[model samples]
Target: MASSCIGKTWCSSARVGLSLSSCVASVAGKRNRFAALLQREQGGRKVSVSSSVRSQSDPIGGIQEGLVCKPSVVTGVPSELARSRRRAGRTSQYRFIMAQAASADGAAGVDSSATFPTVGFLGLGIMGEAMARNLVKAGYDVTVWNRTASKCASLATEGAKVGLLPRDVTEACDITFAMLADPTGALSVACGEHGAVKGLGPGKGYVDISTVDGVTAMKINEAVKATGGEFLEAPVSGSKKPAEDGTLIFMTAGDKALYERASPALDVMGKARFFLGEVGKGAAMKLVVNMVMGSMMASFSEGLALGDKIGLDANTLLEVISLGAINTPMYTLKGPAMVKGQYTPAFPLKHQQKDLRLALALGEEVVQPLPVAAAANEVYKLARAAGLGDADFSAVLETVKSHSRGSTSNDH
Candidate 1:
């Protein structure tokens, strides 16, 4: 496999905070907030931080467990373009992370820390509510905020404090997480007047789980950091089921220190995680993954349509695919529904289209060709044009049939 560099090299081992505050030397008579962490040369290969940042087996920043081992923040980034992202797959300590508060009988994994920090959640949509509920059920003190006050009510009944504003939630908690529907909402809540950042100060952290472009993530990161708060771009990689079941995968980046502090909360919300170095990598990874998924869903729709055109039962075709190596959870969950012309939203079609669009833009930025993503983008656009934006992304099946055999089967 090809090796990538995160701008450093390690021979034995090392870590440092490197106080950016002092490193802010004036350039052209102006101080710079961007700081570079010192590096030691090791054959000049540039450091490839392990795919998983293996935490040292020591308590980190007053938190117990394997949170101590963390990567030094990648430095030398310009003030205008500073960002980082990271997360990890299954690791030993994470097993403890995913566990719920132990039963009253003193079962295993009981969190007895009086210093466990309270968490604040902004946005209460489909994904947000479930994630916040999982945190609350895991015994972390949780406060929640939503534009629609009624949405917060449901979580309030489940032992979460209903906060009056994003500011209210952030002020009252050590870390605040935002899971808004889109970049606009996420930006508004985090950077707006009386928004979450207004309440954020030193020692506080903000994790944004919303799917947004790298530009938006960095904008929020700068805004948060300007106020002495930390930022982590931790966009998730699952739908409603994964969110509710506490099995979502988190693609986290930025603020390795905050990553250490938030490990327990992250473990509660995700089954697996990867700490991609730097802020935009997490968002980049999600877009790349979703681009493939969107294309696959579009191709799957084509397969179903071709089967129906050739006089095969849609269910039979779906069963055959399931038994084949090409099968996946997307096919298993959306196949039958597509065959029956059901498009109830598991993940909204518009969101899938949005992800594809973002992926294409990222490709353009890096000069990567994304021919397949471009084609898939068109199919999703067709579904949106057919008024299936709010339907499951699998609704592209209907759009596929219309394009393939001129069957106007999307009238539902």
Candidate 2:
């Protein structure tokens, strides 16, 4: 592997067949120079290095900043290394190369092994557990904690160290990520007694990937920064399956340097990431996305109910919709299950309602009229009232069907 530091960003190129461990061993003596390159001074203070470079597209304009590890030209290698590459697969080799390069730069305080940053994850709920697992799978030294300690058992079995409290996780790790269910939970984990913030200091960073209001996110940012720790609010855009599959989209804001540092882990857990600038933008963007999704789900439920009432097969309606301009993965994935009255909770109805409530409040704060979203919020409330709170958000169809029944009976 060959590497260079450019403007606080480290770029590395690896020969196609070279093993990452062998490459790291080859450059073991150059650790001091690599460390010096990162410690370059600007004025009297040390310059903060970004682990990634800005893409040709602007991140401030909402495009994803390109991550580090630009691909290097592949060269022919010895037969043994070529066989190794073929055995390990190119994707794994490249990922290993990038991981090693990032570690060797020491921008994120990787250990002497030059392997991975110590990662702490708090809140192992449905989404959180899956995300933490992905990081562990990607070879990070991960510590996990959850409110219900039993939730940590599965991860412990998977080689993640379990923490007794949020502070313990933060104190022991270089970077801590929280994915609580709400702003309240987020605050409680980060700012409550013995919270994550209590363990933070210089060289430690906290990233909250929880769904929260801008105000709440800003509050967490303040608490984290007060501890001399960096903060990033990175609320994701996909639900349980995406979280499990590591294909979620991250809408991130606050602490650009930390974002760059967290890039490798983020890449492990998400397919795309957008740095939207400032502390609350990510929360706002996530709320807006969820608001749109809630409204769409409500409308789709009504459409299905209306079709069934008019003697059209719900499946047929779904098929027609799938073939149309408005087709989306949500509809394609949820429609058939919804038609069968099987809502298995990929994204729970209660959380959808919560996001809708938060989005409506955001609109109210900005004095923007969201009449459609208001209607959808009411529909979700009805679903929750019908004891479908724990069901998939697609269970909103039952409320739509219930409303249809009331209308039909009123005609009698």
Candidate 3:
């Protein structure tokens, strides 16, 4: 298996609000009706902030009445960008976010002294919705936004108020978490012309929990820093089940101070969290892990096909693999399904291919030879061409099996 890094990018400048007015910084500007919370405490007062600020002394203004936010504003990004982020395997806590911000204003600053962290959720899809549900279930005050209006329905049933736009989500909560589908979508929501970037100021923090390459993460980091909002790239490993179980593992990289402030929320969503350093490392590490996974799946597919060529019992082959030194939890979980021809997608084929593509891209940058991964990438391509893009990645076995002379005969 070969490990690799992915693409290039130009950088630029990209919160959640708090429940308590004390947890929030209030400011009044003649031209701008706006406020920003300090990233840290100063004399026990929430730091006040401003946008489009070049120096430390810039002042924030007020909100304009009747500003219309696009549907994407509430869902973490615009609908088109959000759709792009959602390829196949990746799921987001987008749904929960939807319900929270379904109403114009979230439950009026839930009794500050006893209020839990008010969360501003950007992106309200499958995983995003589930995670938000858990937070609501845990009694956390959550505000949500999504690209589409319809997605907010489930969450609204849970007593969540939907936001009119993305900025509203930030204004309604203390801290905001972004569970977008990809870097573009995450960035779109955070830095678009009327995106979250425009809404953030100091004292607010943005956590990006999407699986994009390092370059994208760095771009986001720069944007957040420019606006005085702290940024962290905290991508996760493990698929939908792990997210639902709250046992996902976080690969985080950012300022240590921001990490401390975000840890409690991260802890609620994931079982393990690693502070990888800087902004891009977490994304970098995730690519490496997926590279190995792509290679492993390809190798297993070859092995299973070869075994069948010699008349080996499918059950026996799986059992033997499970007991061998090469045994891995991934194989154990997917192998039986491969043998049984059940490829109901836990992780989709197209997404597996995307990860492999990302891994190979990284390999090119690092000058690492990955003949195995390269070959696997081809196989994944074939799987995609065969119209199995939406199928489970375990379906990789089908390609090998169907192509082999003996296995094809057995299929009939």
Q: What is the C-alpha lDDT of each candidate?
A: 0.70, 0.75, 0.62
Task: Give me the candidate number with maximum TM-score.
Answer: 2
When summed lDDT is taken over every stretch of 10 residues in candidate 1, the lowest stretch is 74-83
Error of 1 at 108 (Å): 20
TM-score of each: 0.74, 0.78, 0.69
lDDT of 2 by residue, 202-303 (tens): 778899999999999999999998988899999999988988887889999999878867765776687778899999999999999999999999999999
lDDT of 1 at 40: 12
Cα-based RMSD of candidate 3: 15.2
Pairs that collide, model 2? none
State candidate 3's TM-score.
0.69
- Model 1, residue 247: distance off in Å is 0.8
Q: Cα deviation in Å at residue 373, candidate 3?
A: 1.8
Number of backbone collisions per candidate, in order? 21, 0, 56
